[model samples]
Target chain A: MANTETALKDVMSSIDGAIGVALVDYNSGMALGTLGGSAELDLNVAAAGNTDVVRAKVRAIELLNLKEAIEDILISLNTQYHLIRPLTGRSGKGLFLYLALDRSRANLAMARHQLKRIEAELEV
Target chain B: MKRTLRQFTGRRPPVLIDPELLAGPGLLDELSGLRARVPHLTGSLVATTDGLVVAHDTRGLEPSGVAALTAAALGVGARLAEATGQGEFRELLTRGELGYTATYAAGSFVVLTLLAGPDANIGRLHLEARRAGRRIAELSDAVLARQDRD
Candidate 1:
């Protein structure tokens, strides 16, 4: 199975317009690993902060009694597309992969598809 | 020898230096800071190499028990590393179905241990933990270095 470093490398190299990526644990709001961020976008801090976003969505699902699982969450900024996907694998519980893409250059659908594939092969 | 007999008496004070005494409150802060840096980490601990609790940020688990186990593991790991010509023991990591248990040698006298969720990224854990381990070793050893400033 691809480890965290290799998985992140694939995410950055294969994905178009990828700005930054992080694997985060929502429980304690830590970014286990981070890659590809500029001074304007510190991936570690940015991803850790998104723990709140993931937690809120999970809580909302529970409170609403919507038994459906979250496939992903998206936030579109002026120039960036932020993607958050909670891993669905048995071993990936409580972890999510965060990716930021350049809105102008990224094909959102392909980025999402690649992220999903990478997550599947990720063994932690 | 009198020194050898003193050991059998089992009354000698344990620990050369208290982790808290050597590092003080900053030790706790170090542990807390690590908890913040690493994601999905349940907790972290720093203990004497011989199985004494120093500073810990763990939850719902016995720090002393883990400390004791750390000593046991360290002994075996050190020997295994040496026997296999791996040089000095640096770190060890194991994964279970649900989580990870990682150990890093902080200094000659202490170790750092961490427990993280299953999805915890191993690469990130190593990066952060190695930094923490070096910091702890320096913090603790600085005290001894001051005394030995001959």
Candidate 2:
């Protein structure tokens, strides 16, 4: 059972081109744990703000009546890829794993695959 | 589409109907019933995914604010479920030192929020609230369809 802090450290250390990572509680719009953010990219704010993005997509899916679950929501920016993966574990409900990756060096497909693995290993 | 759904529903000089009017009382009944069934239930409310209040049985706390915040929490919770490969959102529960706040998806666009004292029975809460959430969804969905007809 990977704890929240170690699980986040694992994400940062193992994920290539990782700019930052955060474990966010969407229920309160707060980051339970965060690491590796730069001045330009505040993990706390990014994690908090992405809560809205996730919510918007959920609403969109419902409004459109598209009956499918989101695997992850990826925001591909000019120089960054912001990945939001909601944790599936029993203790992790109402929270998500947020990772900001540098587009130039990060492999999107591989990053997605790894995030999924890390999510399963995460206890909360 | 939403505006069109809010229409007049009765006889000549038809009365303007709040969409909730179709299901609000039923929703309220469900909320109150849950409170009565579960001891220490401080309050309960249902809201649209957009944060609009549908029905509530809360006290002291403002229903509108709670509704808005519930929408916000629902978003993240739903997304979190999606990310983790959970098929769909079922329910979310949070425990505070003083009490517990639980949310269950009523449908695609509605949620039921409940508050219980610290001493409240968590297991019973889930069993009861889950049932109430489903009924709320049915009630809300029926309202939505009714609005479309109006």
Candidate 3:
């Protein structure tokens, strides 16, 4: 099992063009761990704010009657790609990994694949 | 379209239905009916914003604690929506390894929470839950209105 801090560190370096990364608790809107955000990006605020994104989507899934599990939620912008991956295993419940990547340099498919691997290895 | 608490009142409304009224067979029947109509619904309950359990049909879980957590989640959900310009908070759903928990705003004072397996039909759950929520609101509102008169 990968430690929370170590796993987050791995995510920052392993994912290309990673501007910032945070492990957020949707339950209380708190960031359990964070790495690599610039002054323009407030990692904690980003983490906390995304809790609603995770929540809104989950509710939407229920409302829409979709039985599928959330693989990742992607929000694309002019310069950035915000990727949210909700951890699924028993230990990972109520938490998700938030990754901010530069759209120009990052590959979306690869980033998602890496996030899934990190989620599987992550202990909590 | 989602309904905000603002539609009911300019301010937060107090719990109108008494605890005794919550435990009434009428509400219990409504909850049971919702569970029956919706596939994969393992349990259901109604709780106040502060986490007080008004009525429940939960199995193998502590109704009181779940009610309180639902209130907490609702608070965060509502604030998050407003802050992000996502509009009013209507419902919240969280998936776990074992199952899913979905909470809906029943009315001004109480929220309806439902539990379901991963395979449960998400569409049906919402449809049935919302219908039950309307009845719950009417029943609770009427009781509170009567109390105000007395």
DockQ winner, 1 or 2: 1
Residues A1-124 of candidate 3 have per-residue lDDT tens digits of 7989999899999999899999988765668899999999988778656776777798899999999878899999999999999998899898899999999999999999999999999997
What DockQ do you compute for every candidate structure? 0.07, 0.02, 0.02
TM-score of each: 0.59, 0.48, 0.51
Name the candidate, 1 or 3, with the larger TM-score value.
1
What is the C-alpha lDDT profile of model 1 across A31-69, one tens digit per residue?
Answer: 889999999997776765787788779889999999899
Give Cα-based local distance difference scores for all models. 0.81, 0.78, 0.81
Local accuracy of candidate 2 as per-residue lDDT tens digits, B35-149: 8887678999887666778788988999999988986777777667767877566778989999999988775467789998876656567767888877877776676666668
Q: What share of the true interface contacts does each candidate keep?
A: 0.00, 0.00, 0.00
How accurate locally is residue A121 in candidate 1, as Cα lDDT from 0 to 100?
94
In model 2, where do residues sit more than 4 Å from their true spots? A1-124, B1-19
Q: Kindly list the per-residue Cα lDDT of model 2 for residues A70-116, writing each as its tens digit.
A: 78988999999999998887898878899999999999999999999
Which docking category, incorrect, acceptable, medium or high, applies to candidate 2? incorrect
Name the regions of candidate 1 deviating beyond 4 angstroms. A1-15, A19-56, A76-80, A86-98, A107-124, B1-23, B32-44, B56-65, B82-88, B93-101, B114-131
CAPRI category for model 1: incorrect
